[model samples]
Target: MRKLALIILVAVTSQTTWADAVSDLKNYLSSTQSLQANFKQTVTSQQGKIQNSSGTLSIQRPGLFRWIYQKPFEQLIIADGKQVWLYDPDLKQATVKAMGKALESSPAALLAGNNQFERNYTLRPLPSREGIDWLEATPKQADQSFNSVKLGFSQGQLMQMELHDNFGQTTRIYFSALKINPKIDASQFRFTPPKDADVIRE
Candidate 1:
């Protein structure tokens, strides 16, 4: 029947599109070594309160990243491969922990680490929207913090990420002005506590 044939055609086309999106994401991740971008993040609580923050992010492969939140407040999170530091300027406090322990359930770990995506997550493509190709990644670990993560790419550049956590909180981050494989100084990943700040090592 003509109608049955049309339905099959549509299903095949959808599957092909999904496959292409996943392949495109894998290729982009494999080719990128360093990246810098400006980001806007919105976190919505379970009760529906929304908070917005803007920041700049720089990341290097093999687990190094710097996230600086500059709007509404100033907070810095840096991972120097072996150690991770979180500094709250207003509170004059810094917390340090081993990177492996701190990033176990973090989205940053997925993006910045050298882990194989297929091994750690089940990836599927979402319908394209607003000129962006979207992919959904569900972590293999049942105990992970987030329920699911979605990544969006525009012309092979990572442009957005959305995460749904177990506690019913959702965080969406939009990336703009992305620079791929940029020349980043290694010193950018290092953090030093302010002289007057209290440092707590976890």
Candidate 2:
């Protein structure tokens, strides 16, 4: 189970480095105004001694995302690219981000207008395998939470990911059953408060 969770996390959020040859990722990202993919995640802490809960991630480029935790307890986190919304069913409470990016180094930020993402980070390309290309990025910015992020792509579609924190803690995710360019409903990115839910504006 520990292995599975870790693998899932690695697969869903995998990123490391990439080759600038052909603007490899830039081209694929440029082709679509919006995109979405599924993800599985495992987080290990204590310098890689403990296994954290597994979860799924839903991503919509240009600043919309949903991360759902399916293990341990169910929790929902929605970010419309600008602000964040977190809902924990067990607690029946939601935290609203009045402002600011909680996860500023979020990879989805790459989906935003091209601002030379490499300015704040160094990028490298890994050899392709299993029909998927890999890239590892190391952020130069000091305020960010994690040490590095790895992204995986299969024929231009993001398939998996892995994130390693400063403490040697790693979170891996795998994307499966992916669907791109679907007729996404309007309600997908919008987050409204739930009745009786606490709204904290930070």
lDDT per residue as tens, model 2, 1-202: 9999998876554443244322556775566555555556777776556555656555565566677787878888887756778888878788887325435455656543234566656877666667778787887776677777787777666767778877778878787776655555556667887798877776
Candidate 1's displacement at residue 154, Å, is 1.5
lDDT of 1 by residue, 26-127 (tens): 777788889899999999999999999999999998699999999999999999999999999999999999977446446776679775667678887688
Q: Give the TM-score of candidate 1.
A: 0.92
Best by lDDT: 1
TM-score of each: 0.92, 0.74
For residue 41, model 1's alpha carbon misses the true position, in angstroms, by 0.6
Report the lDDT of model 1 for residue 129: 82
